[model samples]
Target: MYSALKAGFLALPYLSLGALAALDGHCPPLGPVLPAPTQPSKHEAVPAAAAALRGIIDQVTATYNGSAVAIGVKSIHESKLLFEYAHTPANKEKRGAQKVDSDTVFRLGSLTKVFPVLALLKLKDRGVRLDDPITKYVPELRGLKKQAREDSPVWVVDWDEVTLGALASHMAGIPSDLITDIAPFGNLSAYGYPPANTSRMLGCSGFFGTAPCNKTAVAFFEHYGQRPPAQVPFSSQTVYSNIAFPILSFAVEAITKRPFAEFVTNEIWKPSKMTRSFTTKPDDALGFIPPKDIWWDANLGFEGPEGGYFSTINDLHRFFDAILLNKLLPPAQTRKWLKPVTATSSTGLLIGQPWEIFRAENVTSDGRMIEIYTKTGDLIAYHSILVLIPDYDLVATMLLAGPEVSGSAMTLMLSRIIQTLLPAVEQAGKAEARAAYGGTYVDKATNSSITLSLSDDGPGFSISRYVIRGVDVPSTDPGSTLPPATPPRLDPPMRYRLYPATANSGRQTSWRAVGTRGTAAQVDKADAQIVWPMASCLTWAMMDRVTYNMGARDHFVFDVERGKVKGVEAVGYGVFMKKEC
Candidate 1:
């Protein structure tokens, strides 16, 4: 998901901050009931942690050819700012040395959408239904009859099923960019003339050129307001839309009457004391998400609610903390804001309001899995991510100022940083009873999913099974929009013997690839057909090589389902696999 090949998941440094993570919470929580982020221990390892973290940033900048980066990591469980690093190249082509800090402002890219979604959720809390037709608020979207043409450029939205919830959750069938509606992988390169993803419609130099643009993002909205819908009905796929949020802004404005920025400022920012946060004007912060690595002069009249704000780390942190801490929204509203819109998504993770619901694999000492609610924002010049470990009361954020030349360089850096700084959840105490956590829970969301075989060491099942590749990437390029050939045969499953508490001599799980099996890569190489007793040992050899160091460690999440094992989240080589029955 972070643009790294699945194989990249296995290559992180073998450092764990588990013991250090047990340190008492020195930082304060975002709210009263929430736990504070874990503070750095006075255990003398803090210096090493800082050094290693800085070294990683230095290495990443060097390899990735970045201009500057600002990163901050803290435990949301506590209030301490554990680590902060800001670096800019010494000699930057006549652009003097820039040292960013907590006060520095950053262009949040699509992350700006979270603010409108927050406003929407606040309205929802006040009895505004998400299921209401979008036209109810923005009357401009009413009664636009479409006449089919032999060939047309601009497409209209299906005004019928376009609900507030669908638009908010990115299921409204809206195009991703205001310019080009589609930029699917392989169909187009990320950097073509007038690339759809990061085209700046701001100043003269906005659209990868010097001459100022004659139009603004407003034109697209006006045209779409009267355009015809695409051929397909609006359902079944979550298309990330830059235009949808602005349309949402229109809906929000119709409800509030005041300007969107003013409404947010008066309603959310000022109340939370996020004084530095802004949707317009007087932001002199040196940080910039330059479009195409070319800086543009300030022109707020162009870019609108889609992504127009420049914010600080602490301010954005405060914004999220306010939501979590119940300063901005109540617990129920916050939960609704973070809930995924499953009707429009196929992946395990999907959008909640405007945030993404993503969980990685790892267990607490008590064998509980941690769920990380997160959002990653990427502009051409800036890249940022906010990861919330709700269970551990931790929030990790990273913002980089430079071109996202490859992809998600910040994601990889932040991932390593999270792993290095935050300790794995304390392994749960073991039970002498076999199959203590064994149960049959079904996850219809996925097929050929985890099938448990519970046995009794005492009254219950005696042992467990474990599987290789906690996450399975088919070795086929995901960017291709091709149809599947045939479903691969389900191989025999391996059960885990979860680590026990009272037993000092026993280990939780082990692996044995007992039978002949082919990996997705091997099958794809053979035209989606598996050869019995496969002659090639290549795939297995590679898998063994990959897993020798980075293997799956299983965790069972309880709070998710209660009283039952519910499901198993497997982590291998940085890949997280969901195996819930």
Candidate 2:
């Protein structure tokens, strides 16, 4: 049932924008939003937020007894790292264990899933379509026959029906692995299975714990694709399959006629200046290896596409920053690629192109839900998480490694940091907003003015008063001199709130005022509640409905100088309102 809802939601035009801004229309009643900050401070929240996060890291590391931990907080808006933390066990120097820092390398298990999708996207200009089936490139997969079972009709996945996009998004219905519970260096004879007569048992059954498999990309796909599917393709079910990513790499290899490693290193890592990242394990002197597992280095021949890469905090930061800033792909494609492709049964959880998105509710003073996009990677000894909060242009990265540190440590640290940092960021954002945009602007030449201010309980700046050439913009004029027999010329009251628009250039930004009017039967808190056809979400009906001379009446363009507002242009009226006391 939820699958159907997801499908319908995906069908909507501009869903990426709509889903992110779904709550923007729900404005706080005039006086009850967030309490406006009295003064805007410079990085006022960074030191305290960093301290709180460091405390969390200390607690988690002590509890888990981890050998190394690194955390980074960065702001994409300012292109700066707000805070960074690095830690190692106290007695490390006694035994000569290398200390960890932002540049230290750590294995990024399934977080490597993003690379295949990015490679495919880069090859889009080469006539590679994500909707193309796997069989189109590697035709050998078509020869895999389904098992004949008396009770089962569908015994294996129909590779013909699966597309690259579905695989990247975890909607391809592939099983997680080819061999279940088969260790890299273990014997199946103890489990009651007969000893193999050939080397197939030793070579074919090996997984992450064992040496790299000797199979080629095509052979690996043929071996894995013959298994029974976890769900039907495009069923909107998210079954995380590590093998799915390798299949995508197979597509990339077939298209480019080059090895996946070479392509990724040259195109992605090198271009983004990710110096410490590697598809294979780097030297011990270069990487931070735990004491007990110091000699643990296994090559992932086929699994390299999924859990085979190693990266550092600095490299990963550069990677995400480049992608988010549209330095890698075009802006339109980047925006579309970063959104959720399906929703899970959990109301707060959604799935993107392998992204585990969480909707954090009530994190801010205004009680606005913030959407956080995250990708977590867990391996034998290392656990890492990369979190992107698109709303505020913030990112939180956590990486941990040790025998005692489990994947839960990453989760704990991520949750704690988000809890501590978001509120601080929200406060900082509000303070900055108030300082830059909260004030009165007047056109001295024409005696026109608008008073905009932030409230303790509002989502945006509220227009308390607006005037244009002696005409009240928000008041009901209704042409008082109209003929008596004409229509009553009723004009309903409008409450205005100004929000930042998507159009931004260098030092200028565009803000639009959205006015909400009382309906015939209005329920203030139930604005999202709907009967049928979603009647309550008709905010579009009231916006830009009345335009003059191709300029929207609600449009206000702010000219910024050094991150502070200089003046606001009322585009509809062709007037510039200079900032004044």
Candidate 2 Cα RMSD (Å) = 6.4
Candidate 2, residue 269: the lDDT equals 89
Per-model lDDT: 0.49, 0.70
Best by lDDT: 2
Kindly list the per-residue Cα lDDT of model 2 for residues 381-437, writing each as its tens digit.
778888898777777787777777778867866788878876777777777787778
Q: What TM-score number comes out for model 1? A: 0.59
Candidate 2 deviant stretches above 4 angstroms:
1-41, 77-80, 90-97, 146-153, 179-209, 217-222, 294-296, 444-447, 475-493, 517-545, 561-564, 572-575
lDDT of 1 by residue, 113-221 (tens): 7777777767874567878878888755643334223234345455556887777777777555534333322235545644444332322323333332222243443
Candidate 1 worst ten-residue window by lDDT: 16-25
